[model samples]
Target: MKIKANLQNLQKLLPSSWLEKLQYIHSILLFRWILHGRSQPLACNQKSAMVFSPHQDDETLGCGGMIAQKREQGTQVVVVFVTDGQGSGGLETSRDKIIQIRKQEALTALSILGVAPSEIHFLQKTDGRLQELSSQEQQQTIKQIAELIKYYQPEEIYVPHRKDCHRDHEATYQLVKLAIFQCGIKVELLQYPIWLFWRAPLFILLKLQDITAAYHLSITSVQEKKARAIASYSSQIQSLPRDFIKHFLGAYEIFFNAEL
Candidate 1:
């Protein structure tokens, strides 16, 4: 009780901006401590795993470490790019050219992670407009996703958390959720956070109930490979802030068992 009171008094004495900075620092330290010394082996062994990315770089940004670890365990890792990723570049760039570059970059990134070209799938949906699709288009896309799921019969699936701020990420989550339901397949669903952390407060993240099922895959040994894979997305890195790169290169990758 005394410690709590002292902390309160200290907070009251600090300026608001300083308090905010301290809060951010505390959050980072807490997150690192939670991840530290909790590293474990890859969750799936010798089973096929698939990742659904809203764009080319998301798979690497959100779950590259896990993906690399799975592949190292002889798991067949498949990456499905849900959108063309043309929206990442400025309007001045040619959309077709951007799409081509992004696809090639994805291939390079996945190759560094031990994924083969044959395992990569592209939905070819229009970027930044996935959520605006007509009912018919939406159904078609869902059916296509279901078909791939059925064909791959992956034992584990990775997708972005539904609460992610990006519309395409949310739409990809919905589509993947529906596809799994339509396929009537029982697969382990692991959700990763990308833009969600950027928008949510540190205190709110700390209070998330989903953290109970969350686990971290140790990527310390493969951190260099993961960094190279992320760097493959040159088109994206050109626009994104440098700090964003640190999130993926952390000692471990976090995953939550999402129920949908």
Candidate 2:
């Protein structure tokens, strides 16, 4: 019954037919085994880390359990949300109202994940339009991110994977890369994939060499906390497909090492 309900939600949100969805699931399963066999258990040893999210709920979706565990270990985790989150609102809702709602939701979610409000940073960049930024605007965004890196001086950084199949995610990765370069900081970059499971092209999936090198972090101890944190994103829970939510609540979180 639960699976059926989630599939119904997915059908409404995605244009793909049932057959296509099944194919996607098959690919995900095959890749999951490959990743599992090759992955090493990730350690929560960093004293400080920065997580860059393309939107409000992405941090929770991608690495909420990791964040919870890191906080438990007394690691300073800074979450940076790159967009205003206004793009998720319905047409009937006012832009400002939705943004405020998303911001509050983010606060509630992060709080559940043990992130202090002071440690959260919202860049307020226009959502869904990161690819359309002017050169000057891009430079400014890069500078802002660089400044944040300088301020945090984290030993590690997390961002969406380059092939996550979302434009915003891709743009965020590029911007963060540039920011690291501009700041001349040497931090381990861990890329988390949100859309790749369902949206990545076959060619990307065929990159076994790269995909197999991914790391898996066990969240068994903090799975409850992660679920609570994910639940706090009420807006997203009610809007996005339920299966998407379920996928994040898995026993482990996967992260790819930066392709330096």
Candidate 3:
């Protein structure tokens, strides 16, 4: 039977025990959702918070809701865009044009989130090539980030989670971590998952127990604003899959406390 064939294929792909555990986890999540509903809106109180985005859209995709909440609370939120995002605009578009478009889009998106133009920093590094930077280039990049951290003296820092699937995300994490260490500043580090949602669902499920302090900040009120911010990046939405944009929506944004 077709059903039996599918079951056999799934079993071949994953051990039966693993499948059972996955089912159990899914059931638990469903039960929790039914019983408790979603979490309530949580305020961000940091006097200063900095987000290091690997590309133009990562910040919005990962923490747009939190950024809006923090801005509403009068917290200074600085967004540092680490790359030009040239690789995201598809092969038809010229690299220079893509960079210009992505930057403008980022500005518009952050502005919609209530961030001032003065608070955004664009590193403009080569797109899709962060992992290939020379050692000197890497040090220079770290120094630049260190300077920003020193200047802002933020109380909270947000960056891509280390285990994120994208090379750029992983490189951004490493850069931020090293910069924080170089600056010798004590701050709360919060790691946000973006590409990990699609690429590493199993890893996330397995590591759920390792999350020390998870924050599911509700963005029901600002969901519209967040959606608008995401829409500002028209080029990305056109080039990338629709699901990529869809993943950032919903009632809440998630962050996990990370240790340096």
Candidate 4:
């Protein structure tokens, strides 16, 4: 009787045909909310965050919605780009041109997302060689981040996870961790995944922080930015797995609070 009752309740949220496909998801999210209770309402003054990206477009792919949501709430957000994306294009495209183009696209993306110019900081490292940085260089980068952490003193920081699939993303994650450890700041750390958004469901286990951002997650908006961002990479796009676009279409801000 309970099974039948539950099914009747589930039917209201989704079509009958989708019940089989969505049963686990619905039950898990339901159980999660029950255990986690509800997110406390944050006052506008307390909504500040720092976001670190391994390269251009990462901020968009990972935390764009969350950033918009915070920005609208007058939450302070600072975006730090770890690389200029020099290696993201083909031989036909000069490295200088590709970097400039990606920078411009990033700015355009920020405008669309409502992040201001003062909030962006570029680390200006070699695009594909972040992992190969000298130990001294890595320390220097981390020191810079430490200073930023001290200066901004954000209550939360968003970074790519150590388990990131890409070398640059993974390296940036490590660098941030070292910096935070060095600074001894007790700020909450949230990890956002681009390549690993759904590689594992466990990645989305963070306390959901929903603040109703302004972007219309319409197919038209997502597709337009997605195509432009993907096209910005002339040679790099084909090397991406076939399912990449489909994955980005999920258009949801996912996070994990493992460090918290």
Best by lDDT: 2
TM-score of 3: 0.82
Model with the higher TM-score, candidate 1 or 4: 1
CA lDDT, candidate 4, residue 227 = 49
Taking the tens digit of each residue's C-alpha lDDT, what string does model 3 give over 1-260?
55556655775799755765654454345324422453333455655899999999899989998898888777899999999888885647678888888899999999999999999999989988999999999999999999999999999999997877789999999999999999999998888877655442433243544443656777888899999999998888887656456667777787767887
Q: By TM-score, highest first, what's the ranking?
A: 2, 1, 3, 4
Say which prediction, candidate 3 or candidate 4, comes out ahead on lDDT: 3
Better of 2 and 4 by lDDT: 2
Off by over 4 Å in 2: 1-24, 27-31, 89-91, 203-206, 209-212
- The per-prediction tally of clashing pairs is 0, 0, 0, 0
Please give the lDDT score for candidate 2.
Answer: 0.84
How does residue 52 of candidate 1 score in lDDT? 98
| Candidate lDDT (C-alpha), each | 0.81, 0.84, 0.81, 0.66
Candidate 4, residues 71-173: lDDT per residue as tens digits? 7667789999989888774435788987887787687777666688888988889998889999898889999989998889898888886665578988988
Poorly placed runs, candidate 4 (over 4 Å): 1-46, 197-242
Candidate 4 worst ten-residue window by lDDT: 210-219
Instruction: Name the candidate that leads on TM-score.
Output: 2
lDDT (tens digit, per residue) of candidate 2 on 115-162: 999999999999999988999999999999999999999998999988
